[model samples]
Target: MGENELAEQFGVTRAGIRAALIDLEAQGLVERIRNRGSRVRVVTVEEAVAITECRMVLEGLCAAKAAVAASDEQLAELTALGRAMTKAVADGEPVTYSDLNRELHARIREFSGRRTAVELLERLNAQLVRHRFQLALRPGRPQRSLKEHLAVIETIEARDPQAAETAVRAHLGSVIEALRG
Candidate 1:
């Protein structure tokens, strides 16, 4: 679909869509061709691997801080979101999974009480999502993602700070491995 259609569909102005598309294009998530206009980028395997590496570091910090700062209510909410993420992946809804993944990470950063880290992570997430979406759409990746999400949630719930960080690291590492293979 064209940018105009997309903007109209979302009830946004063409300029808004144009600006967003331009930003995404700069982040390598969209490709603006001479005449063809913009298309969602098809992530290369190497780019996907790189995205995983970046996520490993940011997500690890978020999880570690969550272990220290997450209240019982926040933890419970995280658990619920974890379950929702798992279900979204299991259902093989890549778009839904993408949205849920962003929410899960954002919530973790927010709960961690690290405003600067949260802002940085949010910016990183935009770039990472572009490549991660490619990996998520691969065959059988969704189920594997669900398993990894559950592991991270379990570790965080236990309040084992180091373990939580390790779990997130392992999960993102596995994603890198999967993308490489």
Candidate 2:
């Protein structure tokens, strides 16, 4: 659908749809055609692998550091985020689960207490967002993700940096396998 039709379908104005489309295009979610209008971009498998690989390294490091460095409040926040993910998964709310899952990982990165690492991770994160698989929310996967994340959190809570890192690496490895299959 064109901008006007999309706006009408969603009960919004044409201008609102136009602006949203422009924003999504800027974010690489929509590809603008010279004459054929915009289309949703499909993320290829290779792109997904690359994004997951980068995230595995950066976020693994974050989990390790956060285990060693995060303050009590920070840990609490992370735990709360994990619980939110768990609830979403249990409820089979894919959209909420995916969002909370991302937030959980981002929170770990944020609480790592390393400015350089956080900045680098955030930059990588923006690029990876475009490649995120909606299938991550497939009924069983979110619950599995919650369990893996809880393992990471347990290590973090114990201040076992190496264990936390290993947990994240293993979790991400599973994700890679899932993506391949």
Candidate topping lDDT: 2
Score residue 13 of candidate 1 by CA lDDT. Answer: 94
- Model 1 regions lying over 4 Å from their true place: 1-44, 89-94
| Per-residue lDDT value at 32 in model 2 | 83
Question: What does each candidate score in C-alpha RMSD?
Answer: 4.0, 4.3
**Whole-model lDDT per candidate:** 0.79, 0.80
TM-score of each: 0.72, 0.74
Candidate 2 C-alpha lDDT tens digits along 1-181: 8977898899999989889989988776678898888898766767777777887888888899999889999889878988888887777787887887788887888788777877876765565564454557454787777789899988999999899989998998878777776
Q: Against the correct fold, how does model 1 do in TM-score?
A: 0.72
Candidate with top TM-score is 2
TM-score of 2: 0.74
Residue-level lDDT tens digits of model 1 in 1-181: 8888998899999999999989988777789988778887876677667766777887898898898889999889988988788778667687787677767777777877877777766666665655677777788877887778778778888888798899889988888887777
Give candidate 1's whole-model lDDT.
0.79
